[model samples]
Target: MSALLVRHEANRLGRDIAVGDIHGHFTRLRAALDRARFDPAVDRLFSVGDLVDRGPESEQVLDWLALPWFHAVRGNHEDIAIRYAKGNPVDQTSYIANGGAWFVTQPLARRPVYAEAFARLPLAREIETPAGPVGIVHADSPVRDWSRLVWSLRLWRAARDRAMWSRDRLQGENADGVAGLRALVVGHTPVEDPVVLGNVHHIDTGGWMQDGRFTLLDLATLQAIPPMG
Candidate 1:
């Protein structure tokens, strides 16, 4: 692994909030931030990725990268987009079929730059705060032992891909816990509300749904900040 695979110390600031998959809909992001009275100067926003695709404003999702307070791990959708941008036709087809048709509409020249940026996104984030250390991953945190997972990441092993695409962890009757994590925060599994299984919490509420609101899980408070009306 290299620096890309190891756990780097997190930069803690005022208030740190973890957001579910945005899936584009940049306006909703704004609304959620506004509704929570998010102060960018004094607050921090962490994303679970899927920042683009399937919404009206997919193209604008990249703009969030410019914000100093915004941080994220790569979502599975972002993985596919990175592949497609890197000239992988298989991923292009898969991405388009999975509500990412707009990806093909973007100007070809800009995709390389976008793909480079998206590919550089971390696969996991561990933040140590006054509340304790919170871990964030896009989809699932495959291993129960966080150290084993970190080792796998450093070795560039098979478990790396599983972290971004696996849903089996959320399906079983067993309430498996990720060992050594205070709370493992995940997206990609949309629920009517936040679902807590052992130490794992799923916050992706399918905000694109008609009744959904972009959820911002406040780490300082460990509560979902209300979304816009």
Candidate 2:
């Protein structure tokens, strides 16, 4: 797959929902979808990634990936797993410290399968919505110009890494937002609630944590759907 994937005129017949970092919490995700009345037969779900690690059911990542209605971008945790699977230099200790124990403890033979599957995910995704084109990246965009980043991702390793790992936008609290796009949704930094800095939306509610709430943002409305009890 290309470093960036663009889907134009999507979800014409149904709603498009974008969710925060799942971090292996499938049960919570399912509940949230249920609350939102998500219908896989029509409604499509988009994830900002970090689909594995930090929560129970980490081993079920592959099954989730197989869902036709589910799409995801590559996140930092996935990046670490890919590097380890390729026998490339990776900080094993740090990876384990950051909720990667599930992956580390998996059978060695399974690493490649996970890596290959995750490698097919794009670092960033652009989906066309009625409001405009919305961008989804694991972390932050490389530059303020969303169009430029999309055009350069394949040849720009720096941009790809930034898309998966950078938190500058959140840290600096830059509200200028990206151009050439309606909104950019991301999920590396966990916020108490969905926070919108200009058009960049941070929706990772730390769903992997015991006290965290899994949030599902309506892509068409750019609003958080209140999870049903």
Candidate 3:
């Protein structure tokens, strides 16, 4: 498998935290980061994607992503937004119905900018840290042809095609429930609670839903910050 070895210099004494879907709730996101003692100047922040849509502050979230310390993978929402920006035929009705109205309400100038940003997000990223390797993506794969699956442009095209599914369906069979060298980290289907099934972990806690909470996972210790409130 071809993977980029993403290396970052360790801070004097800082933790590398990977967070799940933000979904535009900047307030709660900020609070969670603060509670986790995340120092943007030193500690690194990686997001599993879905940084926009379904909540207030979508613009603010995009602005925050432009920061150097923050890295992210492209989520399905981002895929739809890019298609919309390019004037491609998208499920506008479904998108708007599902909090996509926020993007439409954005200033025209900002729309293109955020769309470009979303388009630039990586499909998958390999974080090579002192501890181990972590692979970040919006979802996992269950196709037993794992090697072929990762190399297939078709799989990525399908994911970017804006197909909608329930949380369970989205989880598929590889829903962070297996163990391997490449630990999978993802945030697509929001969960009532973060799940740790093997070497993979699902951190999307649905901060946009009622009684929802944002979560950050420390890569080095493999610990979930805030202890699941």
Candidate 4:
């Protein structure tokens, strides 16, 4: 992955817009946004994570996600990078089998940029909306009681730990989804179609697999914008 220069501050908005796992499909992402009439100049876009790896254009995806108009949480692939960055013993076999080698093979000059970008991404985002609060993460969050979990430190820490370890138990309908929050948006388990599980939305539609289409979910309306391709 290449280094993405953060030219501006993070986007903080009361409005709603959320995107699913990009996985390096820049052309498709642009086309989807165009179809949806997304205006980065005004509206905000949130990513579910896994912005890189297992794709032909990881560098471009990194650069695109780094744009000021978008925000993303850390995914399992990112956790692998963090471990690699820290010289921690990673599961080399699984990491490479899962496409970590591509990222490791990138030019050294670009590694720092990716590392910095990864370091800056928040584990979870709290969006204050008229309806209520929306929580965004790469996978399932630890908020057992969605209503009480809004902006809670305990929930954040649990979600952060699950993200970092790539724990499978944290992927699906672990604890019956969010209770009180308006919605919990996440991307990790690639689905043939984007799924709305209770208050949770699974937006990773396997762009790396069969027709190579990525789905972007509109947070406010819960609409799935299929890949433009």
Best by lDDT: 2
lDDT of 3 by residue, 13-111 (tens): 677788888888878887888877788878888887788888877878667877988888777888788888888898878999877998877777878
lDDT of 4 at 192: 79
Q: At residue 42, what lDDT does model 3 achieve?
A: 80
Please, what are the lDDT tens digits per residue for candidate 1 over residues 93-178? 66677778887777999887777778878888887666567888888886788867777766664576777877777777347778
Stronger candidate by lDDT (2 vs 4): 2
Candidate structures ordered by lDDT, highest first = 2, 1, 3, 4
TM-scores across all candidates?
0.90, 0.95, 0.81, 0.79
Write down the lDDT that model 4 would get. 0.67
Ranking by TM-score: 2, 1, 3, 4
Clashes of 1: 1
Candidate 2 whole-model C-alpha lDDT, 0 to 1: 0.88
For each candidate, how many residue pairs have backbone atoms clashing (under 3 Å)? 1, 0, 0, 1
Report every candidate's CA lDDT. Answer: 0.78, 0.88, 0.69, 0.67
Per-residue lDDT of 1-229 in model 2, one digit per residue for the tens? Answer: 6447656466789988999999989998898899889999999899999999888888899999999999999998998899988989888788888888988887999999999999999888888888899999999988788868867777788888898988888889889999988999999999998889999999998887888887788888999877666
RMSD of each: 2.4, 1.4, 4.0, 5.1
lDDT score at residue 9, model 4, on the 0-100 scale: 30
Cα lDDT tens digits, model 4, 173-219, are 45466776677877787777777767777777776565746676666
Highest TM-score model number: 2
